[model samples]
Target: MTTAPPDSHPPAAPPSTDVEALRREVATLREESSRLRRMLDTAARIAWSHDVRAGGGEPVAPAWQAFTGQSLEAFGNQGWLTVLHPDDRAGALASWADAVAAKRSFSTRYRVRRADGVYVWMLAKGTPVLGLDGEVQEWVGTCSDIQDQCLREERAAFLARAGELFSSSLDAAATLATLANLSVSAHADWCLVDLLHEDGHFERSLVVTADPAQLPLATIVRSLSPVPRDQPVYPPSVALTTGRSTLVPEVTAPLLEAVAQDANHLATMHQVGMRSLLTVPLMARGHILGALTFIITKSGRHYGDEDLQFAQELANLAALAVDNARLLQGARDAIRLRDEFLSVASHELKTPLTPLSLKLQVLSRAVKAHPDSPLAPVIEAHVETGHRQVRRLTELMNDLLDVSRISAGTFRLQREAMDVAALVREVSARFAPRFALEHCPFTVDAPESVPGCFDKPRLAQVLDHLLDNALKYGAGTPVSLTLTADGAAARIRVRDGGIGIAPEQRSRLFERYGRAVSERHYGGLGLGLYLTRTIVEAEGGRVSLESRPGEGAEFEVMLPLQQA
Candidate 1:
């Protein structure tokens, strides 16, 4: 990209002799080269040419001095390295050397010191200028300042990293760590994430600094910050109370005097060379969760309006994390409370079952002994009714205990080798009198011996629920209990000829407190089917039902033969 130099002299009038002609040609070429150099500099591009034979030399073009406001004497051969950023100097030099040795073009990005002493990003490049016979002559290149574009790209990268971190986890601690790492990038020297408690007290949840050595000191100082809201001294505290952002662009003496709560905090601020600060409240669903604090110190970086906007974006992610953690914690607390209540309530209701059962037994024995008496028939009938009532009460209490065990995560079964078919027959016999009372025919089809390992009482309870469900809903319909088994598992079926379940009701019939029919027509705790399913699954089994409106419902319980 050569152009005419500001100072150029036209070739002298042609000479009549050979020596004069050669001299005139040389002067003409020199003026043309000077004009090209001037054009390159005027374009605001640093055009440089290094002598390949000398290995390296002062730039043949004066573009560097013209653009940077530095003299060529100041940038003698290889002196350009002095103005390069220390981190980029070694690499830039090595690249130049390799390009020259290989006689090829080279390009790289590095930060160069401008005349104003500010470092600006530059794209340095070089291309070999070949002579006749394909011999390398010089390396020509230009350096274009790309500082503003580079800054913009870096900022975009920072925001992308922050977004990735926020989406990676829901844990509060991990989210805090992400925020800390984001600040470590060019944004700030230190970052802190704080959470407000239910009582409106601030908890310094996390504090991080890009400088590893300063982390401990930052943590200690943060622990003592957020002075009383009435004082509203620190930026973090002010941001929290107002539900807005606070900025301390310059930590001047007057600013420190007002911000610091005491000498200890002030000393820490000075020790950390805190200069600029921004604190934005972490808000979630219109609720202030906490604050995200960012600090710039001796790094000379200051907070600006764009920085405030960036900080608020980061704060939003922090707020979402805080809100998610709070919700999970609240759910846990509620479950804990519910389990405790279930345990207490079950024990209280079960306490009276023992005495009630004993009293019913005593009454039966007395009526049996007075069978020949005149009022024997009526007394026997009353005793039988009492027995049925006692049985109902016992089932109710047992359901409560099962629910409590399930809530406590302590539901267990005592496995014993037995004939499952025989067990079913025994439980069915207990329901015979009730079937007779309701004028419903009852039947049981069970094999003589279908061996398996199971909790006898739990199986009996399951049978009680299935049979009772049938009798209650299918009151006048015939109720049948059947047991069958293959080599791998045993299956029990309870089918009733009553009003079938509706589609909507059947779906939720197995849920706790779920009722398929109105209480006015049928009475139950609605835990029968739920407990049935729970106990069956706990024993490595499954329960399912097929029902249709106006048809009948058939419940099938399958239990695996093997139990561990």
Candidate 2:
């Protein structure tokens, strides 16, 4: 036990604690903790940590407590799953457990209850922090708010589907029903469409629900007096009257009672389990078409401003489709009426014209017989003018009859073996007088024998229309008609040096009642080209136009030599 020298021996035992070193270590830990808290606060990431060994009994992070309004004591033992949506909890737990067992990364999506009681969608991801032994020490994760993004994606998909469904049909009632059904299947538990009649009363156009078993109840609800105008508190009535959207996020008993009509209605309303209501006016072209009502029931969805906006968008599409259907129906009705009138009038007028034409011919013969008399020339001229006028009237009546036949799908062709060149020459000869009257030069280039099996009368009529247009629009310029046998088809071209069609007007030239020039300036019905095209196509031929503004126009008709 000899005492060692001061230099070799260890220094006298230090103080019980090195105060400076301990203080520095404590300061460093506090700075680290403050830095972590600042990082968590600044990022959208909601930082959370779970003790791997503690299992369900582990304490939750302060961020989780703050974000979800779950305190450590409240979250004790049960784990964070207690705060998750019932539908999402099991899936989230399964994914998290798998990641923990494998000691790897974890990722999942879930709906968690917020302080405001709304279950918001979140994307949570975690990375296992391993100890030195390579076992999982803990799990560090962050939950990002994805509710708005999820809703936006869902809404976009729904609108795309709705657009397709609405545009698929043109029937007004069917389109309305589709809207209601689509709304129920996508966003709402129940949907109803109410149309406003001309008498200012509402008619329940349709009602649809997500649950088929509830259809009977939905029918009863639909049958309920179509949202009386007196009840301004009713969602549909309010929307229709104000022509604005209405949203009730929460449907309270008092509100239901306020809107219910009678005891049974009230009881039925209660049974409906309405959690929310949204109504939007269906409007088009400055008129209110109807009201579209959406209701959330056992689905537990609340109507917010965003939902109201979506409902209004849907209402706009439905209204447009309904209005378009109505317009189309009205047009069809008008066309039918016009066709009926034309069919009756043409026959009635033609009945008198036959006898009238006979009388004109008799008078013309009697006047010609008195050619030696002084007044014979004057009377003969008058009679000839009467004959011309009757012919013009007959042509007009025939045109109207042809139009009616085409519209009714009764236009038929009597095909025969005939020379198309002879037909073209005959039609050109008929227009010679008119071309001379207008001082327009006309020419026809054709082979003497261009025979084909075709509808001779219809082909003659087609040539007649083309020559008539050339004579009228030739503007006193040269007009040419060329017919040839090209391969297995017969080609006829009528070229006119007159006011040519504009590019845009050419497309409408063959449509019924379509005209490029003003009717006030030109004196003929606009049906000539339409009839020509119909007759030509019926004979297994096609008519095409080549024209430009301020230039000449050329119309070509290609007819199959052997009709099939």
TM-score of 1: 0.75
Candidate 1 Cα errors over 4 Å, as ranges: 1-54, 57-174, 372-394, 435-442, 471-479, 497-526, 545-551
Model 2 per-residue lDDT tens digits across residues 361-468? 898889778778898888877877777788877877888999998888888888889988888888888777778878888888999888889877778878878887
lDDT of 1 at 258: 79
Candidate 2's C-alpha lDDT? 0.84
Residue range with the least summed lDDT across 10 consecutive positions in model 2: 56-65
Clashes of each: 4, 0
Query: What is the RMSD, in Å, between candidate 1 and the native fold over all Cα?
Result: 7.9
Which pairs clash in the backbone of model 1? 3-35, 3-36, 4-35, 5-35
Candidate number with greatest TM-score: 2
RMSD of each: 7.9, 5.0
What are the runs in model 2 whose C-alpha is more than 4 Å off?
A: 1-15, 18-119, 130-136, 156-171, 227-231, 343-345, 367-380, 408-410, 414-417, 436-441, 501-504, 547-551
